[model samples]
Target: MAKYKVTMLKMGTLNGEKSNMTMGRNFGITTEIPMFSVAVEGNGHKIILDTGIKSLEWARVNLGEMYVIEQEEDETMEGALAHIGWKPEDVDIVINTHLHYDHCGSNHLFKNAKFYVQRAEWEAAFNPVENQQCFYFEELFGWSAVRYTSWKFLDGEAEILPGIKLIPFGGHSVGSQGVFIDTEDGVVCFAADTIGVLENLYENCLPNIMTNVEDGFKTFEIVRNNADFVIPGHDPVMKKYQTTDFPKVDKIR
Candidate 1:
């Protein structure tokens, strides 16, 4: 196809400002994070990755429950789209990097769009014990328009549209995937929460947590080296990578 444009849409902000107790000592990790809704504008197709936060219903209901992390803000997928001058329905395809709450919760918002998921990820969320939340699988069902567009596990590289492709970076989750799209400027990869912050690269360290540590490290290097432009997950650095006013997305040589 012709040239394409990739834009990082800020969905909203999440307050992860609260401190978590690890080994009884107070760890000072900032809680508030910038949620994002990434888009790929190809010749005639548009593909989106990871629909940001859906709502705080789960946190509000399970306030004191363990594992119920509360977010400081409530920027739904719809709000992010509105801010970008687009509608949730305008997205042609949706990619769920993994089944994590923050990543896939907004899948419901794009009920009309075709869903693309890794085969292993879909099955992991499909099986009873393998699944975490019911909505993980339920949200994709009963929607007459929904379809398992492409399975990344079986099909290593599947182009989302023409220029938008899914890169399997497994191990973060069973089938945690990354997206690589060729834009008019250069190659941009939607690396969902893999090497979260720029620091995730500086030290060449894993997140201290992962489904598969070894695999995570290897895949991380590949992502870091391959993409001409890497848009990290959760961090606000995507749009703020360069000058504030100009927002120049510099291509790595």
Candidate 2:
């Protein structure tokens, strides 16, 4: 097995209703949500888990005031990559946990990398349900400049590399997946929207934004069973676990 080093790249932050992340709880509270892209390095390859949002202007014009999205000077895709001494072209693979605007917004940057997306996700992205339609932006991934040959659409669980795997569990969306990486300590699962915040997993609460609450809880168990350390999709606490000491202690069972 090839052990890899994982780094969480801060893409930006979103200010939104806490209920959006914790389901029925925190209905009247607002919070700052951190967005990230996981960088996995090892096995002589460099991979990016997600690509953050496009830009503040793009978000404002497309998403409006539903939430305030902001990216610091060092949080752009390029900036974040540079912070880790990486360039877009240097990326060997790019795997998207899902195609929501925030997760795939910077897809256009890594022209040299092979992109991996679930077959279901690729289909749903184009014909998403009414509510999720707002989060799927074609301009980001459907640009004329990107070649079709760059994509590898998966069907289910797949070990893309020696120790990196893709786990698909549609709940947050019609086709949301999570990335599993082998590390020195154990397996680390980048539980995307399926585990949007720590509360979702700890409290067994589904995010109100999910497409299927049942599937959301199943995904939670998936993380608990497989991951020694779990990283939530948009938790501010993620800042402390940029590397493999993830979550401070072993993930909650």
Candidate 3:
């Protein structure tokens, strides 16, 4: 059995309404959420969980002024990889929690890697409802289909590798999945968009953005019960848990 080291790569930040992140609370309040791409490295494998958005302009134009993006010129996808001693081509696998633009925007960068996404997510990207269009960019998906070599569509919970599992739980988006990693400390769950902040999970709140509110609550409970600790999708609070050995990297266990 191999124990993988998980690191959070901060791609950038986005400012949005607090209510948008935590359902039905903090209506007028605004908050900045950190955008990240988690790297699970070990056993000679470099698997990335969601390839964080690359275009600030596109995000602004699509998401609107309510979502303010703050990304430095140097904060490119390749640059984030290099921070942890990796290159774009060094990635072996790419797992998208869902097909949201922010999560899958940089898929083109990892052209050599195999992408693992939920079957429901793949279908939703192609035939998105009106509300989903803001988050799911058709052009980005088209680019990925033409650029990436392979894609593995999962139906439910399955172990993609020895100690890593992909658990599907729809909430933030239909067919959204969470990554579970067995580590030295315990099992760590990347809650993905199901819980974007610690406040959401701890306070038992759902994000305003969800395809199914009932599933969102259920997904939150599932994540809380299953993992030792969770990595939220867009929380800057994760920075406090950074590993001393790796700069800009947070350890799950």
Candidate 4:
């Protein structure tokens, strides 16, 4: 097995109602959530989990009203990558856990990388119904088409590299998938929106934003059973494990 080093890249942050993240629980509380793009290095490959939101304007135009995104001038996907001594072109693979605007917004930056996404996610991105419309942005996909030409649409579980896998579980999005990476400590699962915050897993609460509640719960169960360390999609608690200051990256275990 190939052991990899995982780094969580802080993209930016957002303020939203706790209910939005914890589902039916904590209805009135509001909190700030940290956005991240996990970088997995090993097996002679540079693979990124998801490209965080592109820019403030992009967020404002697409997701601001819903998520209330707040980004500083320097908090950019490119800047984050640079902090890790990497450029977009240097990325070998870009794995999208889902196609929500926040998750794939900066995908256009990785022009030279092969994008791996779920087949259902690709379909939904192109043909989102009313319930899924708010999450998928046509503009982002249009921009991505122009920059990223390589795409590998997957159906279910797949081994992208030795000790690296993609497990699809349609919950948060019809095509939401989690990336499982083999690491020194054990397996680290980037559960993505399947488990949006630490509380979701610890408290056994599902996220409010779910396409399929049953799938969401199942996804959480799968992650808990398989992963040694799980990384949630939007949790500031992740900052506690950060090992690098420049990129604000966190180690999973």
Query: Which prediction has the highest TM-score against the true structure?
Result: 2
TM-score of each predicted structure versus truth:
0.76, 0.95, 0.90, 0.90
Model 2 alpha-carbon miss at residue 107, Å = 0.5
Which 10 consecutive residues of model 3 have the lowest summed lDDT?
Answer: 244-253
Query: Stretches of candidate 2 above 4 Å error?
Result: 143-145, 248-253
List clash counts for every candidate, in order: 5, 0, 0, 0
lDDT, model 2: 0.85
Residue pairs in clash, model 3? none
Q: Compose the digit string of candidate 4's lDDT tens values, residues 1-253.
A: 8998888888889888888888778888878888888888898999988887878887786664777877654457788777788888899899999888788888888878889999888888888778878888766656534344588889899998999999997678888899988888778888888788877777778888888888987887778777778888898877722533312112322
Off by over 4 Å in 3: 60-64, 143-149, 244-253
- Per-residue error for 68 in candidate 1, Å, reads 8.9
- 169-237 in candidate 3: lDDT tens per residue? 878988899998876766788887888887777777888788998898788777766777788888877
Instruction: Assess the local accuracy of residue 39 in candidate 2 as a C-alpha lDDT between 0 and 100.
Output: 92
Off by over 4 Å in 4: 143-149, 240-253
Candidate 1 off by > 4 Å:
17-26, 62-74, 127-154, 240-253
